[model samples]
Every structure is written in C-alpha cells, then in structure tokens.
Target: MFTFFIALVCIVFFFLFMIGLFLTIKSAFKFFVTKSVTKKQLLSSVIGTFLFLLIFGVTAVPTFGNSSDNTKKVSKKSDGYDFKSIKLGMTQKEVSDKLGKPSSQNDRAITYGNNTLYFADGKLTGGSPKFIQQQVNQKNSNDKQKKADDSNSEKSAAQYFGSKSTQKLADQASYVPRTQISNGNMMYSETISNVKMYRIDDYQTGVTTVYKADESKDDGLGAILYQGKTVTQEKPKTTIVY
Candidate 1:
C-alpha cells in the first residue's frame, strides 16, 4: 500500500512538471515576441517550472529504486533448480548440461550438494541417499520439524537394537511411530545403516522387524515391512594383532 502511494505521488509530480514546463515556454515566447509580458511574471513561471521538475525527479528516483530491489528478489527466487528437467535414462553429459557440474562424482553417481543422481550403463537411473531428493523440490518451512524428527529417529532407532535397558534409552529420545505392523506392533525408523535400512521394534513383544529402505517413496525409510532380518548395531570389526 505504501509503495502504491509513492508511485501515485511520483506520477502526479511528473504531470505537474510537464504542465509547468509548457506554461513557462509559452510565457517566455510571449515575452520575447510581444514585449507585453511583465519580466516578474515570466521569471516566476520559470522558477515554478524548475521546482516541479526537481521535485518530480527526486520522487521518481526512490520509486524506481524500490522496483529494482523487488526485481532482484524475484530473480533470486527463480534461480533455484528445475529438477523436473532431469529425466531417467539421461546420459551424464545431458544431466550436467541442465544442472551444471556435480559437487562430487564417481562411476555410478554424481552428487549435487547432498542430492546424488545415480546412473547405470552410462545413463541416468535414479538418485541416492533418498532424503536429499525428497527435500529438493520442497520450498516451504513446514517440513522442518519432520526432518528433525527423521534425524532423531535415525540416531535413536539404533538404540532399539540391544537389551530392554537399551530400548529404554531409545524410548527416552522421542520416536514418532510411523506405522502399525499389527496390534501392539509398531514400525519406527532407526536409520542405523549407512545404506538406509529400516528397523522396526515391537514394544511389547521385544521383537524387532527390519525393512530395507524402499527406493520408491518419499518416506522410504519408514514402515515398508520386511521381516526376519537380524538387528545388529553397527560396530567396527576388531583387528587381531598377529
């Protein structure tokens, strides 16, 4: 509303400036031609014309200055990636042409910051570390808390691996139960694997159901239901001194 007011005032000033300039030119011409116009009257017309132009120019500067800033903000917003341009079966060169260079790359995949694009037989297959691809197209702040929940889920999900005492520690860290496997059996994600697997534990049965990360869903890390997998907390193998 305030911007509109400034713009309107600038237009009014410009209109007045044009009218004053026309009147001043007419008075000057009459003064020189007929010699009947008073010098004081002509001088006053010139002064009024100068004031109008000066005021209009000053007001016009800030109006355009504000518009320039708005244009920059729009430019910044449009600068983000058009991920839809990336299609499956695109060659590595084609992907690079659209998205520029990757942050890191190897034989199978190229990474853009956190998001990785996977390839097979020198053509695009899909992306890796699934969380990043899910986050790529989201422009709002609504999912921020859910992301924090996922990280916490990963950290404490491993806590469900061991004895009852360990499960107590996992329970204390706050897990958002994503799915119900059965009555009294629930699925929660413990992102204990670097390869992204799901570990589901039953609170009452003390039985944990593990699922491999589903490649298809945005919430691929949670509640996809694979059974009979052993839950072992990740630890380094001990080296024996020879």
Candidate 2:
C-alpha cells in the first residue's frame, strides 16, 4: 500500500510539473514571437507558474515526510505476523508465507509472539481466539477444570500429552494419544498407552475442550473407559509375570 502511494504521488507530481512547465514555456515563446502579447499577460503567466510550484512544494514536503513515518509504523505493526490479514481456513503454508516462520508450531496451532493460529485438518479454524493477544481461549468451565484437577489429585492426566490430530488431546506436547476412547455419558478422551488419557469433549457441558492433559499414573489412571460399554473405575492392576 505504501509503495503504491509513493508511485502514485511521483506519477501525479511529475505529470502536473511537466504540464505547468510546458504551458509556461509556450506562453513565453508566444510573447517573444508575437507583438500582440502584453507585459501583464507575461507577468500573469510567471505568477501562475510560481504559485503552482509553491503549492505543490508545500503539499509534497508534508506528504513525503508523513510517508516515512507511516512506513515505520507499518514495519513495527508487521511484528505480529500481519495478524489483521489472518483469516479462517488458511493453510499452514499460506500463513507461513505471509508471516514467515512462526516462533513455534505444532500440528495443532502455530504461535507468533503472544498470538496463536489454530489449525484442524490442515486448515485454520474460525472463532478460535483473538490474534495478537495472550493465550485466552476460554471454553472450559472453571468448576469443571477445577474438579478435574481435584478428582485426579493435583494434576489432571490430560495435561501431559498434546494431540494435534484430535480436539481432545491437542494441548499437551511431546506425545500423541494412541487412541481416543469414549467413556459413555457423552464424554471422550485420547488414550496414551494403557495408563491415562485426557478429557476431550465433556458431555456434561457440551463444550469443546482444549490443552489439558490428565496426569499419567501407574495406577491405570481413573474412571477412563477405553472403548468399553461402561466407564471403568478400577486403578492400575499389578500382575506377577512368571
């Protein structure tokens, strides 16, 4: 946009200057070649040229001056990965091309400073969160998250692994859920081995959950029913291998 403005200004200014110069020279030649031209006509032509140049100079100086300041402001604003241009359903490659490489990225979302862009099935999702601000994708009920923490001791098992493939386990990094197992009651979670899994969609609230992995425990975790008719409540059972 700034480049366009610069080019436009130069073209318009050059065209106007050339036209004024041509008219002034033509009038001067008419005065010299023809005795019919008077002194007042010559003086009017000179004053018109001078006034035009003065007005153009006054306007052009401030225009170019403001252009420099505008460029600096735009350069600083670009630091946020052109957050204003970000839209829903943009591919990872498309976004990277516009914003350069993200500060950090995963299969789920790409982080740029305090901003994050969420993706699913390789396309950006709309209504995720406001870009260029701290991470505040609020969806979990405070009571539910607190209960989940309290129910599983201090940490919920789902807070460990980030699963980019499924909405349930997309928060925790460094590991992926082996599979998502439904625990009836409309609740679901992604399983990590046979030990623990994080809550995906809580049927109780019907809201989509985000990065919150349940803590892994050797006691087979808690109440996680892996593809069973009923949710299991048994802890990890130890066995002796003969």
Candidate 3:
C-alpha cells in the first residue's frame, strides 16, 4: 500500500515538472517573438518553474524517507524467527516429535543416579550431579513415607479387624500434590530414559520469547535450547538511480 502511494506521488510530480517546463518554454518563445514579454506571462513562467521544483522536492523527500523506513522495518522483521508452540511436561521423545532433533547438547553429571540434560538447537547435552542428587533424595523421602503408611495400615488392619479403618486408610492414601516450581536450574524428569525436555524460543534480534511451561531470561543461552531451525522473512529490495 505504501509503495503504491509513493509511486503515485512520483508520477504526479513528474507530470507537474513536465507542465512547468512547457510553460517556461512557451514564455521564452513569446518573449523572443514579440521582443517584449507580458508581465503576467513572465511571472507565470517563473512561478510555474518554482512550483515544479518545490513540488518535486516535496514529493521526492517523503518518498525516499518512507521507503527507507519501510526498508528498515522489513529488514528487522525478516531478521527474526517465530516460535510456534510448546507443551508442558513434554518428555524427550515428545520434544523430538514436536521439534525434531536439537542442534547441540551439553551434559553435566549430578549425584545419586540423577543428571542434568542441556539441549541447544534441539539436542541433549549433559547436566549437574548435585541437582540430580537432590531430586533423588526428595523422591526417596516420598517413597519412605509411603512405605511407613503401608506398615501402619497393616498394623491397624490386624488390630481393628473391621471396616472401621477403611475410611482412615482412604484418607491416608489420598494425595495432596504440591505445586511444581521452575527455578530454571531444577532438573525435571524425562519420560524417556535419562533425558529431560525443556522448551524455549528466543531470537538474537530480541523480537519474541516463547517458553513451553515457563518463561526465562532472554539470554543467548535460550537460543541453544531451541531444537529446530528458526523461521524468518526476507526484506524487499529497492532500486536506486544514480
């Protein structure tokens, strides 16, 4: 739309210039033939020339300015990519299914059969051991609590010998789940093997940030987490005359 407007304006200015040039030539011809130019004709010729130049200048300036501005806008828009979508609790396989393979991976070893997986460009690398150990410990504690509850249930069953403890057992078995926290460094469990999945979308141009379950800082690191190629636009070219 803007391009069409600029072209229209240029065309109008070119015609105006042609009209002014014709008037100037006519005035010159009249002066030469009559040996005396009418004041009105001479004034009209000067005014037409001035008006032509002024209109051309006015039209040309904004055309160039808007063209430059649009060029920049298109360039910046083309430079970045769009992150499509993400899902929470996505396992490694699920992530691969969604985003294909990662571009790179960095692995760090953590303690107690736990590990951290870092994915860049859609591939898994490695992770920390201490964090994994903490996660293992938490899981172990939960397991121990479950075991204790089972033992208590058995004892109550032997002592009461009736259905009176059924409600109590049901109440004890009911789970009160805690909210999951994403501290960025915490390692989430992977549904496939030892690999955990995290989704991230970011660009170097600082355009958009889309994360799967949570948002993170717009550092270059997030770019590594992206498992696929980024989608972007290309700028339109303009021709310039010398």
Best by TM-score: 3
Q: Per-residue lDDT tens digits of candidate 3, residues 74-111? A: 86564332122223223455544644454443232111
Once fitted onto the true fold, the runs of candidate 2 whose alpha carbons sit more than 4 angstroms away are: 1-22, 31-37, 80-242
- Each candidate's root-mean-square deviation in Å? 19.4, 18.7, 29.0
Alpha-carbon runs more than 4 Å astray in model 3: 1-13, 28-36, 65-68, 80-242
The order by descending TM-score is 3, 1, 2
| TM value for model 1 | 0.27
Model 2 scores a TM of 0.26
Error of 1 at 90 (Å): 15
Q: TM-scores of all models?
A: 0.27, 0.26, 0.28
Model 1 agreement with the true structure over 43-77: per-residue lDDT tens digits: 76777678667876776777787897888887656
lDDT of 1 at 154: 51
Tens-place lDDT per residue, model 2, 153-190, is 42334333322323333343335433434554232344
Q: Rank the candidates by lDDT, best first.
A: 1, 2, 3
